[model samples]
Target: MIMKTEKRKSVEDYLCSFPEKQRDLLNQLRMLIKKTMPQMEEKLSWGAPTYVLEGRYCLQFAGNQKHLGFYTSPATIRQFQTDLKPYKTNEKNTLQLRWDQPLPEDLLIKMIQFRAEEVRRESLK
Candidate 1:
């Protein structure tokens, strides 16, 4: 018997779809997320770059006309509500990063770490 497999779209392919300026920011975010958790899998989902750990979604990235969006869980958002005040957040699980605002590296690392742990914990249940 013969088996067939399909190739999946890579994160790099997704990043290349954006314009130069937006691509740069998306690349930087992708690198940061990779650095935070080297073991996570990167894939394209919902037309954006998404990171997953043990079959659980850890983070996602999207670009808009005005800002770059980093998405996580609502529980993670609530955990870092104070630090997120500088950026605009909507009912969805996103933290908007405008071009003018510097990326909050420390907070982002914390958020990623927390989400990774959360995903692991939930998977164990």
Candidate 2:
């Protein structure tokens, strides 16, 4: 017997699946990304909202129960470690943005810009 794989939902569907609070937070992040990097393509990747540039992954974010997961390249995380000190971060590329805290718009913009530049550079190579 042959089996079929389930299709993943679009980014909009993924966002809509979350609760109101999480949805609002995710939308804020999405808007910020769109504003900062209008050229990047938005898609659903790894069950989350991902921004891509030149067919390369720029950044991705997912809503969790207590925090939103912000993911980028490890190099970008290391570059902004000091600014991210207050937030919870993993050894890899994940940064946890707590729901109770305000979104660090400026810091997130810098991180997103860094990823965009990195993706652009990689695309040229």
Candidate 3:
């Protein structure tokens, strides 16, 4: 049997607020996270689309004029620092994916998976 999907707010509304080009990219990113962690809670947090698991924030993604921002915990950033070194990042644990370059889907998937496990560990502590 086919299961119907319920519509989510805030994140959808936020994606709609962007231009088509950026909107498409944001949509793809959102879907990827949802596919990877269907049980995670999603909402608008800190002016971006955030995912939380078991009361702990797992990840967040935002779109900018020139790039997309992927936000996660500092531990994740440090853990993936070598792989993420090619991208621009900040001390706040955000990785910037430029509009001019291709999206690193594999790296992102790894980061999301890592964050999900981290969130789980946090909730247990």
By lDDT, the best candidate is 2
The digit string of per-residue lDDT tens for model 2 on 1-125 reads: 11123555798778777777778888999999999999999988887899899988889998877789999999898999999999999768999998878799999999999989998899888
- Candidates in order, TM-scores: namely 0.87, 0.90, 0.87
| Candidate 2 clashes between residue pairs 3 or more apart in a chain or in different chains | none
Give the per-residue lDDT of model 3 (tens digit) for 33-93.
Answer: 9988899999888877999898888899988767899999888899899999899998678
Error of 2 at 121 (Å): 1.4
Q: Give the CA lDDT, 0 to 100, for residue 90 in model 2.
A: 78
True lDDT of residue 30, candidate 2? 96
The local distance difference test score of each candidate is: 0.83, 0.87, 0.84
Error of 3 at 44 (Å): 1.3
- Report the C-alpha lDDT of model 1 over 1-125, residue by residue, as the tens digit: 11122333776766666677777877888899999999999888977789999998889988777888999988889899988887887656889998556678899999999989999999999
Steric clash pairs (candidate 3):
none
Residue 86's lDDT in candidate 1: 77
**CA shift of 40, model 1, Å:** 0.4
Q: Name the runs in model 1 displaced over 4 angstroms.
A: 1-8
